[model samples]
Target: MSEVVLITGGSSGIGKSIGELLTTKGFKVYGTSRNPEKYKDSLFPILALDVRDLNTIQQTVKTIIEKENRLDVLINNAGAGITGPIEEIPEAEIKANFETNFFGPINVIKSVLPQMRKQRSGLIINITSIAGYMGLPYRGIYSASKGALELITEAFRMELKDFNIKMTNVAPGDFATNIAAGRYHAPILNDSPYQKPYGNTLKLMDAHVDKGSPPNLMAEAIFNIINSKNPKIHYKVGNFMQRFSIVLKRILPDKLYEKLLINHYKL
Candidate 1:
């Protein structure tokens, strides 16, 4: 039987691309959306799911298992973005981002584990961000939330080893997606101390996303991972510079790397 796959936040963007490609490859794909009705024309079924809502997460998983009898792969691609100066960002927004980007995926994983363990086989691929590897000036909150997910996946992988289940994190660099449209942006207050710098960073961030690589690259990478016998703990999909930045952080001194980012962002 073909692998049964579930991709959260799959109504559009990277998740949509992954789901579409996998479906064409003969994998049974179900994508999730908060408003499933809006995506009636989606190539794959769009199950109603809200990552921040435990009840919705549980029901969605149950629905899939009831129909498919098994869920062979889970792509935890549901997440939100927030961009603002750390101090200026409201506490509520920060927590909200964590709810969607961090705790949300954890709950979804928990909901699916029982069935996965019963089958003694499964693969969970978390869609994290390249920014998760390090703090970015204006997108600090997004970085922290995704970074937390990355670390937790490392621990989760070890915990799932005994159950014959595999867990991995796939961090993508800027992709041409609608994430920017949905991201929360703190107002660029004319009198606020960070007004000029924050505004400039925001513009640069948008430009990067506009010029980002195709989302299908991520789909191809995930497809390969699903077919592999031993998938790595972490996989990164992006342009050379974006992937190299992670390596540079490892080899460069803290301050030197900070300087490079500062210059890159023109902070």
Candidate 2:
């Protein structure tokens, strides 16, 4: 039987690109998006799913298990983003981001682990971001959600070691994904008196996302990770600018790093 993989959020952007790549590479790809019908014409199987909905995740896994007999890789790639300063953001909006970005992936991982454990060999890749490691000025809530995911992934790596179930956290920076296309609209923070001057931040952030790297590059990176006989615990990929920033964040003093980001981006 051919190797099989299940990817969440496979309808568009990085997830969609990964699905297509894995299928072309001879892996049987089963993907789930909330609106599967929109991707009806794709060659691989696409199912409707809401990752936060345990029932949806359970049924999706059950159906795949029946068809594939053994699942080889599970990619928890479903995520959304929001941007706003922490104090100015509402509690509900914070929870909303966590629901989609944190809880959603957790639900999928919970559903897949049983099958993965039974097999004693499986790869789980969480599509985290560079934001997970370092928070940015405007995207506090989104960064928090990914930060939560990073913690969970690290814990899983150790806990699942006995079962030989591999878990990897991928942190990519500035990919030209439709991510900004989703916007995630962080509630009405502009209405806050404290956040009034930052009304233009959204436009600035969107401009950066629009001009970032292509989704195919991220997909290819993920493709390589999934195919490796021995998977890694974490991987990072992005454009040269992001790479430099990651390095600078380490070598530069705290005040110097802050000054560089403020002066360079004109924030």
RMSD, every candidate, angstroms: 0.5, 1.9
Model 2 gets an lDDT of 0.83
Which residue pairs in candidate 1 collide? none
**Can you give the TM-score per candidate against the true fold?**
0.99, 0.93
**lDDT of candidate 2 over 1-267, digit per residue (tens):** 788899999988888889999898999999888888888898798997898788999999999999888888988888888876677667887887898889989888888888889999899999988877666777878878888898999898999999989999888887778888675664545467535435567777778788888888988998899778887777888877777787888898999988986675467
Residues 1-267, candidate 1: write the lDDT tens digits.
988999999999999999999999999999999999999999999999999999999999999999999999999999998999999999999999999999999999999999999999999999999999999999999999999999999999999999999999999999999999999999999999999999999999999999999999999999999999999998999999999999999999999999999999998
Worst 10 residues of 1 by lDDT: 78-87
The local lDDT score (0 to 100) that residue 157 gets in candidate 1 is 93
- Stretches > 4 Å off in candidate 2: 187-197
Stretch of 10 with least lDDT, candidate 2: 188-197
Instruction: Please give the CA lDDT of all the candidate structures.
Output: 0.96, 0.83
